[model samples]
Target: MGNTTEVTFFILAAYGDHGQIKYLYFSCLLLLYITICLANIILISLIYVDRSLHEPMYVFLCSLFMNELHGSTTFFSVLLLHILADTHEIAIAYCNVQSFFLHAYGTTEMYNLAVMAYDRYLSICHPLHYSSRMNSCKMYSLIVFTWSFAFFKFVIPMSLRLQLPLCGNIIDKLYCANYALVRLSCQNISLNNILGVFSLVLSVAVPLIPILFSYVNIVRICYKSPKEAQVKALNTCTPQVISLLYFSVSGFFEMVETQFDLTYVPQLIRNVCMVYLFACPQILNPVMYGVRLTKIRNAFKKRFFPNSTE
Candidate 1:
């Protein structure tokens, strides 16, 4: 209503204010970042180099690891910056870039999980056709589609945000999320909110529906098989299912926080959920897929320390 002055910068809330706690937080997050990078890198490398590990499942695992690396890097790197500077003033341009990457990676991760679920669906439901159905060309196409879909889903809302005039330069969360940014706009943001909800529904909720249905069918198929085979199937899928569940639920909670009141309790819970979303999957994924696989473990031992026989 006043002058149409555009806000140029936004302030972020630090997760913690106490100097000692902040220090502890930095130290802990740094350690986690290091672990996530190293573990995912090693897992991806092992899958790449080991001929025996070349399969549809391992390919999806590699993609997931890559997504995890990028996703965590986007958020945690900014957190590190905030901690070091002890301030939350971010330029509007930088905020847009951050928002773009965050949504891109988040959406990509969602699609990748969907791809992984479909792969499992093929493997369990149509065992004989799994190989031919998920061939290199098909896999590559799916990967491309995942990235493209994510890009469009994120870019559309981001483009809409660019048109709005920001009134205040203060974002409550540590990251430059779309809803968070939209709330600061002085213009009518009903369109942005509508698009945001639509994107969430399509990119997050829709993919999860198929994943759940696929898993249910997988479980049903496994139930009729021999106990040993069923156990093996469950073991192979348990990690991905658990990872998918955690990502989905935590993601929904974070989205809900954006729409509702942000009290201290919800904020604290959201922060904890964020750690689970960012840290836990990246940390556990490699261990579940690579380290637990005998072929990869043997390859690691053979390549790193040849003479030592375990």
Candidate 2:
């Protein structure tokens, strides 16, 4: 039995113990990380330099890339450190910081996705008024609100965690999450659990409702248009929708997993989900928008190799 005053650290099981497998895993993750960084940076740069790419849709894409960059940065960089060190032990203060930033970025990404959905909603459902409604002031406000809400959602939980006395520090996950922190508490975790559930509902579920409804309505509207127009519209959003669904559902599952006995499930499932959350969106977002948008592709080509034109 561990004493309340004793601080224990968690031992994260690496992806694989086999030397060859570990090497392969590290190599793969490194490549993926590099790809994510380069892709997002180029996309952001293209949006910034090209005046023609300046539209509501591309603006939202820029925001999405920014959010994804930050979100993946928060999680994956820490993950890289863990992979190199071959340990997951974090000091209590560091853990708190990690939790704060992790939740902050995660929440920000969720809100950004909601913004994207709203942009799509306006574009497809109310095309005539999209420009008028989602104007410069409104866009600025939306960006501000997304960041503010993310900060709001994270502040209390982070503060509460700071106040709580940690009896043990055996966090199972690679990074600090609500479940991992709550489990470390020597006091009643009921309040923490309540807040956790509430945040998940608000941050994940609430926005998702509108996003799903928006997409459904978008599909309906698209069906009324010509096939090419419908395909184009669907192409614009399909990646975002896929990303939203994967991240939201996987995130919810990870949250729920914390409530159950960790021993019951295979750690592999958790690891796979964690990797999926980080890897999928970062890999797909650029392709979804950059490849599909001719303007962005041409801009990228022009920017990278100023002499390339066929």
Candidate 3:
């Protein structure tokens, strides 16, 4: 226990000493960061400006896009900095902040998707009552609750880890993972691990309740509805369905990658698997909804290219 608390910085191991390839990494990373930022920003801006788009579904999409921006900046921006710097080392304070935001972002994202699913269900299943049920006030309240819940949820766990005396400062991933940070502690981490497991279950399962219930109802409703109604429901829910499935798959991989030993896999694949969770969703969600939702596509086109006839 000799000055275990003296650790000041942690080296990110996965970035390796790629030397000249760092420029390549920097370029690709810059492109991705910019793309995620610009796409999410434009979607949010469009939603804000176009009154026609001011509906429950679009409002939820705005919240979702905002989370995408939040998550992307939390990891990718910092990753770009490390990839370009001489050392892939992060200060202890900065590492802790990043870990907090990354974990919080995960929780926020899951609940955001859940809320979106619920919005879609109400729109399709209870169209008449949806207006009363998910009004602007209720919608904003839900958004605030999701963000606030996520913001504070990891505080205890982070505080628990901060109290531990760390004997090591090497984080294997390209970013500061909260659990990985906890693992570096030289002291007993039983409490941290137990709380981590409990938090994991709550973060993943709680949001899932609404998502599962909404989708099951949406599916059942469609099953009994007329063909035209079914097609309409399918069209309305396609973006949410795709987002939910993509999120679930990526989240599963992230869980496995973080919780299990996958040393047999190629380093590149493992690394890709780690970052894909953050990057893929931010990149795809805007593009998917913009194209799939005809109203959004038309609204954007009208805003930018009003003269063109469809």
- The best candidate in terms of TM-score: 3
Q: Give each model a TM-score.
A: 0.92, 0.89, 0.96
Clashing pairs in 3: none
Error of 2 at 32 (Å): 1.5
Residue runs of model 3 more than 4 Å from their true location after superposition: 1-5
Ranking by lDDT: 3, 1, 2
**What is candidate 3's TM-score against the reference?**
0.96
- Lowest lDDT 10-residue stretch of candidate 3: 1-10
Q: Tens digit of lDDT per residue, candidate 2, span 196-239?
A: 87887878788877788888889999989999989888877887
- Candidate 3 local lDDT, 209-264, one digit each (tens): 99999999999999999999999889878888788788789888877777777778
Point out the worst 10-residue segment of candidate 2 by lDDT.
9-18
lDDT for residue 34 in candidate 3, whole number 0-100: 93
The order by descending TM-score is 3, 1, 2
1-310 per-residue lDDT for model 1 (tens digits)? 4345568888887355656677787898899999999999988898889887788778887888998898889888788878767567888888888788888877888888889988989988899998899999999898889888888777778888888876777776777887888777777888888888898888878888878888999999998999998987787778778777777777777777778776766566667776776677778777776655667778788767799987
RMSD of each: 2.0, 2.5, 1.4
lDDT of 1: 0.81
